[model samples]
Each structure stands twice: as structure tokens, then as C-alpha cells.
Target: MFAVAAAAGQTVRNAAQRQLTQTLGTVGATHVRFLFGFPFAVVFLALVVAWTGTPPPRPPAGFWPWVASGALTQIVATALMLAAMGERSFLVVIAYTKTEPVQVALFGLVVLGDAVTLPMAAAILVATAGVVLMSLRPGQTASRPGETAGGGARPMLLGLGSAALFALSAVGYRGAIISLPTDFVTAASTTLCVALAIQSVLLSGWLALRDPPVLIAVLRAWRPSLLAGFMGALASQLWFLAFALTAAANVRTVALVEVLFAQGVSRFAFGQRSTARELLGIALIVAGVVLLLWVH
Candidate 1:
């Protein structure tokens, strides 16, 4: 249930992000989203603490380092994802980002000594195959300027890179959660708010010095940006709660449903027409994910 809620939150956040793609370049949009979201994050943490009659746990000496590292990775990942959204179809980008689960599992097994079952390995292969099918591009010349080469390769690369960094963040956060005495969800979520605050302060200071015009635009565009920020922060809280309850592998595999969510967004929001092949690809991906979960 938590997993489902997390996925829904993420899907909504993606939709919100998709709307931001055209107005701000990927980096600018992310900057706005994070910047606007920072204050709400603090409010959210306070609300959670107040409602629960609990305070956020004091971090251990090493906890801040882990949280900062995790946050940095996420910042990079979000920036990369924004770049991908600017250059590619929403459906394609979502499909590619789903690769995070497989990447995270590998990272866990290889780096963190988490065991990987054969079934999990098979599931990873199945998911990879789905990604391959989805990424196939028809004949397009690379020499043509402004033409998308190999369909969505460049965007896919950016998306994949983002996914990888996001996976790293996930693992790092999971490890860091052990240092806190409060609810892991609260701890993780609070860490996110703190990290975002750091990012917002640093970026705001940089922008104030370097580019006042864009900063002014962000100030003027506070209405929508605030909505986006609130949603983004709320989504992060939900995701942190879910992560606290479930394994990252489970959470991520279920989150792959974002591809279906993306499909809906594409069909309705952008009038993106899908071919028979795409529909089939979606079905296969869904089935494979279901099988993977069932096996576990």
C-alpha cells in the first residue's frame, strides 16, 4: 500500500515536472522546483513532527555526511532527468528511468553485499529487454542537425544517468537511516528537507550574484512554482515513508508503474498517439514486472 501511494506521488510529481519542461529549461525548472519546495519541506517536517508528537532524531556524527552525499546525488539526478524531459517523449523517459531498480539492485549486490537471487537477475534481464524494445528508433540520419538520432538516445542517456545517480542516493539514504533514533521515514524525510535547504541557499546565493534576471523570473513565477514545490516535497515525504516500510527493490519495481502513468500523461496531456508496438511493449513490461514481483 505504501508502495502504491509512493508510486502515485511520483507519477503526479512527474506530471507536474512535465508541465514545467517547456517554461524553464531542464536545469532552470529543477532549480525552481527545488527552490520553491524548500520552505514547504520545513513546514511539512514540522507538521509531521507536531501531529505525531515526536521530534526529528538527532543525527550521529557521520549521518550528516551520508545525507549530504545522498542529496547531492539526487540533485544531479533530478537535473539529468530534467534534461531528458526537455529532449524526449515523456513515455520514453519514464521507461528509461525505470532502469533504476535494476541498477539499484546491482549496486546493492555488488557494493553493499546484498544478496541477489536468480529470479531477481532474470527479472532484471526482462526489464532490460523491455527498455531495449522501447528505445528502438527507425531510420534517422545522425548527420542531420536538430534531428533526434536513434530516436531518443541522447535523452535516454541522460535519463539513465539520472537513474543511476538516483539509485546511489537510495542506497546511501538507506544506509544512513540506521543512525537516527526516530522513525526512519521521518529521519529520511527530514534529511531531504535539510539537503534541499542547503541546495536552495547555495543556488539562491549563486543566482543572486550571477543572473538576477532568472532569479527575478523565479520570484515572479512563484505561484505555479510553489505548487510544483509543494507537490514535489509532499511526494518526497510519501516516498520516504514508503522506503521506510519496504525494501528499495520492491519499492522501485512497483514504481516502474510510472511508465503506465507516463503513457496516460502522453495520451492525454500531449496527445501523443501510440502505435500497436508501443501498446504491446507496455503490456510486456507490465507482465514482466508482475512476474518479477510474484516470484519474490
Candidate 2:
């Protein structure tokens, strides 16, 4: 039940982020989400400590390195995902995110020496092929508004880069958890809160130096940004809890349902039309994820 709620929250968060994308550029929008979200997370963590009557545990000697790596990767992933919002289809971005499970599995096999069954390998190949096929500009289908063949390359690249970073982050977090204590939820949450703060500050500083106009736009749209941040913080809290309770694969696989949830949001909330090709891509992604889970 908690997992389902977390999944739903994530979908809502994505919708909020999509709204932010229109008013602010991707990086700028993400910066606002994190900047506003950091304080909420800090308070949430503090509340958890108070309620539990325990101080957050100190992580093991090497946990900081893993936590740092995870944080950096997650920050990059967030930026890339926000950038991808302007691309061909939100469906495309979702499809690419679905690809992350396969990538993480591959990384696990290589880096962590995790076992990969033949069925899982086949599924990975099939899923990769499907993503490539879907990514190709359609020759037969008529182009939709704000979409054209090959126009979404930049966003696609950004999305894939985000997925890669997410995979790295997953691995790092897994390592950190193993090295840390079992009751380290507080520590994990606190670490992530700090990491998000750092990422937001760095992104804000850079944007301020390089693109002050975007920052100005963000300020003007502060209300929406703050709301988005609240949603993001809530979603992140659930995700962190899920990560602490389950393996990354299980959590991410369940989270992939966010794509379907996004589809609903696009249709109803955003009043956007989704094409058959996009629907087909969604099915393919779900199938791939199912296959990945079989191996797990």
C-alpha cells in the first residue's frame, strides 16, 4: 500500500514538474524544485528524529563516498529529466526512464557481479531495440504539434544521460545501505536531504552566473515552483523510504508505473493527446520491465 501511494505521488510530482517545464527552462525549474524542497525535507527529517526519539545514525567509514556519488548522479539525473520535458513526447521520456532498469541490471552484473539469467538478457536486448525503434522519427505517421522527426535529439540525449546517472545513483545507494546500520533510515534521509540542498545551491549559483533571466522567470513563478517543490519533497520522502525498505530494482520497477500515471495526467490534466505509437511504446516498456523482474 505504501509502495502504491509512493508510485502515485511520483506521478503527481512528474505532472507538477511538467507544469514547471512550461514556465521555466528544465534546469532552472529543477533548481527551484530542489531549492524549495530542501527545507521541507530538512524539517521532515528532523520531525522523524524527534518522533522516534533517536538521533540519526552515523554511517560507516566509507558510506559518505557512496552517498556523495549517489547524490551527484541523482542531481544530474533530475536536471536531465527536466530538460527532456521539451522533447518529442512525455511518453518518450517515460519510455527512456523505463529503460533504466535494464541499464541498472547490466551495471549490476558488471560492477557488482550480480547474476543475470538468459531470459533477462533477452529482455534487455528486446527492450533496447524497442526504445531505439520508438526513438526513430516516424516516416508514416503525421507529425503532431511541437513534434518533428529528429528534433527531440537533445532532449533524448538528456533523458538517457539522466537514466545513466540514476543507475549509478542506485548502485551507490545500495552500497551505502550495506555498509551502514539497519536503523539508518534517518541517516539515509538526512544524507539525501543534504545532497539535494547542495545540488540546488550549485545549480542556482551556476544559473545565476550564466543565465540570470531564467532565474528571474523562476522568481516570478515562485508560487507554482513552491507547490512543485512541495510535491517533489513529498515524493522524494516516499521514494527514500521505499529505497530503505526494498532493493533498488523492486522500487524502481514499481515506480515505472509512473509512466502510465503520467499518461493519464497528460490526457486529463494537461489535455494533451497521446498517439498510438506512444501507447505502443508504453506497452513495450512495461513488457521489458516485467522481463527484467523475472531475472531478479
Candidate 2 C-alpha lDDT tens digits along 1-296? 33456678767776677778877867777777678788888888898888777776666778788778877888778767766765545556655665676777766667655566777666665555555445554553314555455445566577778888898787777666556665656755676586677677777788899999998888788788777777778777777776666555555655665666767777898799878776775676568657765665
RMSD of each: 3.5, 4.6
Query: Which pairs clash in model 2?
Result: none
Q: How many residue pairs clash in each candidate?
A: 0, 0
Report the error of model 2 at residue 34, Å. 0.9
Q: After superposition, how far is residue 128 of candidate 1 from its true place, in Å?
A: 4.4
Report the Cα lDDT for residue 246, model 1.
48
CA shift at 250, candidate 1, in angstroms? Answer: 3.0
Task: State in Å the error of residue 65, model 2.
Answer: 1.9
What does candidate 1's lDDT look like per residue over 221-264, in tens digits?
A: 77777777877777766666655654556556666666667778
